[model samples]
Target: MKAATAVAVVVAVAVTLGMVATLAEAGDNNRVFQPCADAKIQRGDGFTFGIAFSTRESFFFNQTQLSPCDRRLSLASGANAQLALFRPKVDEISLLTVNTTSYPAVTNGGFMVAFAGRKYAARSLPAFVSNSSYTVTSFTLVLEFQKGTLQNLYWKRDGCASCSGKSNFVCLNKQECAIKTSNCKSANQGGSVDCSIGIQLAFSGTDKHDAVLNSWYEVSNLQQYSLYGLYSNLRNSLTSQYNKIF
Candidate 1:
């Protein structure tokens, strides 16, 4: 009887430890993917642009979640969402120079602010490339605010293999075309293209909130213009501004 009781006690202790370990693992995962809950915006505050590769056609649409643009773009914790305007070749033209009169206002606590048009790039390259075609396939930009502490910023880009109505013909990035011989056969198919970047915002006002904005652009060909380079320049400029403001 004594031996059985000792075995039972040992088993119970092991089971409790195992449960604790499982809970700890779950907590760690949550911390890593923390969902943005408090992020909100008014309807006209957010806009999206979609472009078709074949026809080089584009269309703009505004979010229809009613006024106050209280829709949430991200469910991940510790994140906020806003609309941004992205220009690929920013060095040639300044984002700040654009007319703000056309921009829509974003409301916060009865205060409205316009979504500033900004530049973003994935990497750095020459400001100009001769004898190359420049086309803007698709573009998306976002602005977000995080209350309290500022943390790391993240961005992602996804591509469709049949974007151009051809199988595996449209390469999203320069690396994708280089990897496959078939993809590189045509200049339109395999060119280093498609890039994105994110910027961290500085803390201001009584809100104690930090802002972040990210932009992504898709080009059918990378050899034409260095979209990544343009994006990089924009990122650097915005980062400098945040440094100065914060």
Candidate 2:
């Protein structure tokens, strides 16, 4: 009888922990997406950002498809668009590279924007990720923080460094390095190009303790983090265990 009670208690603990994990995942998922104009950031908290992109004409709330910095974008039916969500620490430097996962493909003449925090936080400019002619794959983002609060998010151009000397890429106006849309997987019937975007992230300004921070040097020292793979493995493991237990 004593052994039986111990087994039961163990199972109860496992179930409770599982439930808590699920709740945490729920909060971290897409629900974190908030309008850049209304996002709120606080010190010692995770900031999940949203980047909406699409190739369709009507996906945007307006004809211009202004950057998230300027207006709120509406994701409606027949929009044929997708939003890529990610969270990175503002107090540290990191490298993030993401490819199309379960989300719809980003194709033909699409722009994207980054948004975080409320009132005091600023969103990035509307960046052209892909066009009918080309698609950009490498980018550097700078997140400015003041007194532990997020201030602004912006993209730092690399002067075509990623595109130079590559046969598949073209240097546009000596500022952007991009590949022909015909080589992108979605646009080309037999193309092998992966339109993955690499974000080299850096942080500037001070933290809550008023200590200056620079993410550039730190990010340069570490390898890229693959959050997608970690999430997938965890979810799959949980699901497998759940099915076996129940």
What's the lDDT for all of these models? 0.20, 0.50
Off by over 4 Å in 1: 1-131, 148-155, 162-169, 174-246
TM-score of 2: 0.63
| lDDT by residue for model 2 (139-197), tens | 66778777766777788765765445767678877877777666655434334554556
The TM-scores, one per candidate, come to: 0.20, 0.63
Error of 2 at 87 (Å): 1.4
lDDT of 1 at 173: 56
Error of 1 at 169 (Å): 6.6
lDDT of 1 by residue, 106-203 (tens): 10011111221112111111111011222212221223233322121222233443233433233545311112222111233343322111221111
lDDT value, residue 230 of candidate 1: 45
